[model samples]
Target: MTETVKLKNITIVLNQPRYPENIGAAVRAMRNMGIDRLIVVDPRDYDLEKIRKMATHGCLDTVAAIQRQTDLKAALESFHYVIGTTARLGGQRRTGKPDATAEKIVSISQENQVAVVFGREDRGLSNEELRLCHELVHIPTAEFSSLNLAQAVMIMCYELFNACVPSKPAFTPRMAQRRELDAMLDQLRDILIRISYINPENPDYWMHHLRQFFTRIQARAREVSIIRGLIRQVDWYAEKRYRDGRRDERNRIMGKGAAECD
Candidate 1:
C-alpha cells in the first residue's frame, strides 16, 4: 500500500530577509512547490513594489505575511522540525548528507508542521539560529555552493516533495511534541532531585548529566508522557510524606508543652 502525504501545513519561514525581489521569488517558488503557508520575519520592506509584482497570484494572501518579530527563538519553538537552507558552509552546516536529510524528512514528514527557514542573502543562519532545527539539510552543490534565494527554496521543496512519497513505505518514527518534551524534561529533573540523585541547589551539574542521558534515549512523545506520569506519582507520594512528617513534628511539640505545663 502506498502511504499518502499532503502539504497542508508546511511553512516557509524567511528570517530577516533583505531583498524584496528575493521574497517575491520565494513566494513564487513556494506556489510552484505546492506550499501554502509563508512566514516572513523582520524583513526589510513589507511594501516593496518589486516583490509584489514578482509574486503575482501568490502575492495576494502572502503579501501581508511580512511581519516584524521580536523573538525568532520563541516563534520556532512549536515546530516539530526545522530545515535550514544555506549555500554557505562551516558554522551553519548541521550534518546529514542531501539524501540522508531527504530520508529523515520522509520519516517525520507529517508528524507536525515543518518549517523550511532561509536566512539573509548576505550571511546565512547563525550558529545559534541553526541550533533550533532538529536536523540540518544541505542542497548538493558544486564547490561554489551559491544559489539564489528562490532557487534554494525550489531545490528544498523539490527534494521534500520527492521524499514525502516513496514506493516502499519508510518506517516513520513518532516524535514528542515540544510541550510534551518540555514536561518530560521537568519531570525528569524533579524525580532526580526528589531521589537525591540530583541536588536541586546545584542543578547545573545534574542537569548536564540528565541532558546527556536523555539525548541518548531520544524519547518519543508517548514514551515521554508515560515516564512523566510515573515521575508524577513518585513526587505525589514524596510530597505527602514530607507534609505528614512536618505535621507530626508540630503535634509532638504541642503535646510536650501541654504536659510540662500540667
Candidate 2:
C-alpha cells in the first residue's frame, strides 16, 4: 500500500507567475517527480504552444491539466495542507536545513492533498498569502534573496520527490485547510480591531507584523483550528449581545417592554 502512494495528489500553485518558460520548466519538474497537476493563478497568460516545446516529451500532460485560478487563496482551498515557498527568513519563514523541512513536508504530505505554492518572481508570496499556508519553506542560498522561478520549482519538487520515495515515517495528520486558516486570521483581525489594537483602515499594517509573529511558532493545523473555534464562539456571543441590545432599544421606544419583546 505504501508503494502505491503517489505524489500525484500534489498540486503546484504558481501565483501571478510572469514567465512562460518557468511554467514549462515547472511542468517538466512535475513530470520528473510524478506530479501531474498544476494550478496557475492569474499568470501572465503566456502562449502555451511556445512553452510546450520546453517541456520535452511525455510531460505536456501536466501542462494540459493545468488549471488557472483568479487568486492564490482560492487555488489553495482545495488542498488540505499548503506549503508556501519563500526566500526571506528569520521571521516565520522556515529557514536553513533541508532535512528538517523535508521531514516536515513528508509528515504532512503523507496524509491528504497538499499544494506547494510559489509566488511571482518579483515579490514572492505576500504576507497575507503566506498566512494562508500551513508552513513556509525558504530555500537556503548564499547572500541573496533571488532565485530563478523554474530553478526554485525544480529544487522544491526534487526535495519532495526524495521525501516521497523513501517513505520516511508514519503519516501524522490532515491539517487545517486554507479556508480554515483564512477564517482564523479574519477573526483574529476582528478581535484586534475590537480591542483597538489594530485600526480597521490600516489593519494589514498590523496583520503583517502579527503574521511574522505566528509563523515562527510553526503552528499545527489542529492548534490553529482550536484557536479559530474559540474566537468564533466569542464573536458569536458579542454579536448576539449587540443585536439584543438593539432590540431592547426598539422595544423601549415603541412602549413594549424589553422583557415582553423577548
Candidate 3:
C-alpha cells in the first residue's frame, strides 16, 4: 500500500474575506483536497449559515472547525511556514508557480506547521500581510487574470495534494515560528536603526531585505535565539562606546577650564 500523504499540519488561512459564500466554497475545496484546517481573519461578515450553505453538507465539518481571528499576524504566530497567494506581481511581490511551491511546502510540512494564506476576494493580500509570509505562490491565468476566491484556493490545494505523492520526504528541521522570528527581527531593526545602518524613518524598507535573507536560509528556532543574543550584545557595545565618549569629553572640558583659571 502506498503511504498516504498526510496534510494535517497544513492550514488554509483567509485574510479579511468579504463574502460568506467564498469562505464556504473555499472550505469545500479544502475538504475535497484532504486539507481540514481553516482559519479566517477579520471576515467582513461571518455568516456561518450562509457559509455552510455554500460548503454543502459534505464539508460541514470543515466549516464547523474554522478558526476565527481579528488580526492576521496573531492568527499566524504559531505557524512555522507561511505561503501567501497573490494575483498581482511586481516590485517586492515575487511569486513562485504553484507546483514548484507545493514541493517546498511538502518538504517543510514534514517537520513544521505550514499555513497557506489567501486574501480577500476583491483585493489580494496587502503588502504588510505579505511580509509575514516566507513564500508566495501565484496561480497562472489568462490575461484577464482575476480568479474567484474559491477557485484560487482549489488550484493551490490541488497542486499541494498532487505534489504529496511520488515525492520522498526529506528531513527538514523544525523552523522558528512566526512569533519568534518577528521578535528577533524587531530587535534587529532597533539595533540597526540605533547604529544608523537602516533609515529610522522607514526601517521596514531595509528590513524587508533582511527578512528575505532569513527566509531563504530557513532559520531554525535556536538560530533565531542566537541572532537575538547577538543583537543584545551589539546593543550593549554601542551603549558603552557612547558613554565613554561622553565622559572623555567632560574631562577634557574640565581640564581646559582649570588652565584658564591658572
Count of clashing residue pairs in every prediction? 0, 0, 0
Evaluated at residue 54, the lDDT of candidate 2 is 76
Q: By TM-score, how accurate is candidate 2?
A: 0.76
Judged by lDDT relative to the true structure, which candidate is superior, 1 or 2?
2
What is the per-residue lDDT of model 2 for residues 1-262, given as tens digits with 9 covering 90 to 100?
2332347667888999898888988888778877788889998867788669778777877778789899787888767777788877675455435445555666566677878889999889887787777667877788765779888888877777775435446655666566766677878999879757788898987787566555445456888878988888877887899899999898787776555678
lDDT of each: 0.70, 0.75, 0.90
- TM-scores of the candidates in the order shown: 0.68, 0.76, 0.94
- Output the better candidate (1/2) by TM-score: 2
Candidate 3: regions farther than 4 A off: 1-5, 165-168
Per-residue CA lDDT of model 1 for 1-262, tens digit only, reads 4443446546788888788888888888877777767777888776668878878865657666654565566666666666776655574254655555655566566565667788888897876676555556667777786788788887777666666456586654556654565567777787888789887898655675455455334457778779888888988898999999999999999999999999
- Return model 2's CA RMSD, one decimal: 5.3
Which candidate has the top score in TM-score? 3
lDDT of 3 by residue, 2-81 (tens): 22335899999999999999999999999899899999999999999999999999989888889999999999999999
